[model samples]
Target: MRHTEREPDYIIKNDNALINLENSVKSLCKHVMLRQENEHLKDLVIDRNKYETILGNSTPVMKVLRLIQKVEKSNIMVLVTGQSGTGKELVAKSIHYNSPRARKPFVTVNMGAIPEDLIESELFGHEKGAFTDARDRRIGKFEEANEGTIFLDEIGEMDLMLQTKLLRVLQEKEVTRIGSNKSIKLDVRVIAATNKNLAQEVKEGKFREDLFYRLQGFLIHLPPLFERGDDVVLLSKSFLTDFCKENRMGNITLSKEAVKFLMDYKWPGNVRELKAVIERAAIMSENLTIQPEDLIFANG
Candidate 1:
């Protein structure tokens, strides 16, 4: 007679053990995710501190620093408005380097530098044979900046037609190559900088009103050097120290008269002009201190 196969009661017990194992694995995964998030927060804090050191502690600069701290964690579009040389690109860098996507690429495109004919191809890329000169497939700024950030400098200079395309990118998060009918999806964060007043450009009909609104989700206006009060002197000293260190020269100090002249003259080129002036003074100074005569003004 054939013996009946034994039905093991431990099968039910084994099912319970499997459920416990699954629960334990889920708990471990949750713990790992939480730890990663905490590390990211810690990195963000460190980045904020680094930016604080770069941007001085003057009231206006401090205000901007605080704003950077608030916005760096989010992926919102930012519009930085200031005169040329006011460190708009620096501000963009600070944001990107502090965000969750800090490790990703930070692509910068100078809207004013590209020719009108090639601007579209430069931004949205092209197929290998898209244009007459097309020898190889080219990736666009948006694609290069996938899952990262794209800084559009001199955004006001973008043509009206291109503005529409950019607006579509911001809305749809996708781009189509010039010769291809297919659209490539992107996860790019846009940060635009402009020396021109986009509001004025919009009113003047030179800029698209819709695009202006889209880009200006959060606006940061960098004050000119003259308006920054004591920041001029602070920045001058900082630049001097940097120049000295870079050249392997002894420490250089700015003379009282040199400080007076720097404070008195308006910096038309903003911080960039100030940096250039200080660098020149550092190089030209025969003594350890920068004298008034050593400080040359471009306007003069």
Candidate 2:
């Protein structure tokens, strides 16, 4: 007796069969929105071409640009170690803008600004009834920067308890609200900066070593303004050009002596201090040139 059971032919040669195959293929392709692989975890990379246009071209600044370029495409966590007024935030912004996440939110949370009692709620957020004052659901910085970058300024100042929670988030890529048991997934690129010596803090038992290592995937230590050589002068010029235009002061140029004064003095506040000096001088000097005396410092 002949067997009647049979298997269906997988090959399609008829018009209806061909049309069905094409439609299936098209449907699959539509679902696969392939994104080009990021060579470095860095979604954003710095554009050196705009370096001079934005900041300046001194050796120190160039070195900063190189570091930015090197880490621009990498997704590794960045720890910007620098002194106050050293433009740490600026570097953080540069990294974010240059990376692929440039289009996403670049949120900055000043650890020092937030009250110690409320820092937890501000950072990790809380659900209603989490605490006495938490009357409604709150979204924290990590949640706000879910798919973008979060620049945590003064990370060293974060409380020990909060640091533990932050460490958990870094490890699991998820966050739990104050009162919620559910964990929310995160894709944030954390860029933390501090003026403190984290190594020292770790040794002192203040900062968590594990968390430090996690955030220190890539480190960028900014040199002080005085050590940056002629970057002071370069920054001065850029500041002068912008300030004059900003205040409509009829464009003023820094005299040779003025440049010398700025170079010789110690900028304790770094670039921010230098910019303030330039602005004061530009406003004081009515002539086309800014003289040395136009810069008024107690010691200098």
Candidate 3:
């Protein structure tokens, strides 16, 4: 049978939700194209290696880069753990794109955003007339990502019931659709990410212990932005320079005070927050330079 990909359930459920996911993906890889006019901002920040966009030179970041290289050569499941906004998904994509499966689909399933009821159907396809809304046979994310990679973002948020089924797939390398007796085999690399402490969740009887172990067979923990040393300043420079070019505001450099302003304050929201602040500062500051006063935090 010829394979087909229908519009995903999440896309059909909410347009804004889909847009937000798209934006997050772009934010990691294509930071330059926030607006139609800023298309030239593409590749403005990082090196020509493109998807090697996990920008930083801190010891912590270097360790992450090393770990990514180590696991990319093998088909081991990787669990990326970190605080929110730490770019865990970007790390996962980097591993996938660098691995042998680079040419295959890199399907992403945000287990956190999808409603509990629809998540199962979203992960595992449903047969036509399987349920009231099962109007036609559907191919889920796993099937779509066969011979590639499937990123289960916010995997810790998945309900307990589905976790058992997911564990079985991880062990047996096959998935049985919601209303089918046949088991469809998959050759997909599973990369899961979450901001929550899954070990604590397991201790509290929330997450499946076995599944947690399975996912973390190869773990990559991203250090918080504050712990990443001068990376804050590096990201600040890249963000400011790119935003100025994108907006045609010219080459606005960050002042010494502004550099201190970025480095001294703790970035609780990590790189994502830093990028937002830099972009805002670029617009709020003078055309020539970004001053300390131009920088503003969401809390401030």
Candidate 4:
């Protein structure tokens, strides 16, 4: 007898189920791709804002801006030297965010803030049970910054032993964890900043001479605010506008007397001090116009 041939019902249902699963996966992948695109656009916007924040029209400030534009695309070790509050960290951020590594991680380590005993582990990571507080495996800043940038702020404060280790990492492009013999290769760009005079420190045997040369592959010196001339008024106005908006206050302007006072005063704390003074005046001013009397100087 010839049997009637037909596909079983279960086989047909299985085929439909597979087709639905395939469609679901495609939908999930599309969502993931769209999310990634949105994140990239956000990063672009942030980078543009960072560039704009380094504002000034004075010759000295313009020169620094030009240098930033020139070096943002290259992978080089930058040493930014200036007095305290001169915006050395800002320079470092501008370089990292404007460069090709903009999309990558920007890790910052304040050498002055980290304790000497733990700095090595902080930079190179450590294995589980590596030390007393090591309860789990930890990844260090350098590893986290692979294919990105690492900003070493207050680098002059680092001790000699750690400086030697840092020099080795720069030379070899690799790092060995605290308790492991294996080495992990890295592709991080390093940007260091300091308010101290590293050259003087090197001469005094407080800093390593070899490491100093290595870090100063390119150096950018930030002029103090007093030397920047009329840029003080420009920055003052900008800060005033920002503080006003942030506090939801009406628009404010500096009186002629106030402007003169700002221009004449010596900015011992540099741009940082100027910003603080403006913010205080913005809050303390009785009217939309900020007067000379509203300005307050920090104790010398």
Please name the candidate that would achieve the greatest lDDT relative to the true structure: 4
User: Cα lDDT for residue 67, model 1?
Assistant: 89
Residue-wise C-alpha lDDT for candidate 1, range 86-143, written one tens digit per residue: 8898899889888888877789999999989998999999999888998999999899
> Which portions of model 1 show Cα errors greater than 4 Å?
1-53
Model 4: C-alpha RMSD to truth? Answer: 2.9
Task: List the lowest-lDDT window of 10 residues for candidate 1.
Answer: 1-10
Query: Which candidate order results from sorting by TM-score in descending order?
Result: 4, 3, 1, 2
- Evaluated against the true structure, the overall lDDT of model 2 is 0.83
Cα distance off (Å), candidate 4, residue 56: 1.4
Per-residue lDDT of candidate 4, residues 91-160 (tens digit) = 9888988888887888999999988888999999999999999898899999999998999999999999
Any runs in candidate 2 off by more than 4 Å, and if so which?
1-54, 298-300
TM-score of 4: 0.90
TM-score of each candidate? 0.82, 0.81, 0.83, 0.90
lDDT of 2 by residue, 1-300 (tens): 123232223333366698998999887776553333342322334343224243656676788778888987777799998888888888888887778787677899999899998988888899999999999999999999987889999999987888998898888999888999999999999999999999999999999999988877888988888888887888998899889888888879989999898888888888888888889898888678999989976456
Residue 145 error for model 3, in Å?
A: 0.4
What lDDT, from 0 to 1, does candidate 1 have? 0.89
Worst 10 residues of 4 by lDDT: 1-10
Q: Report the C-alpha displacement of residue 141, candidate 2, in angstroms.
A: 0.9
TM-score of 2: 0.81
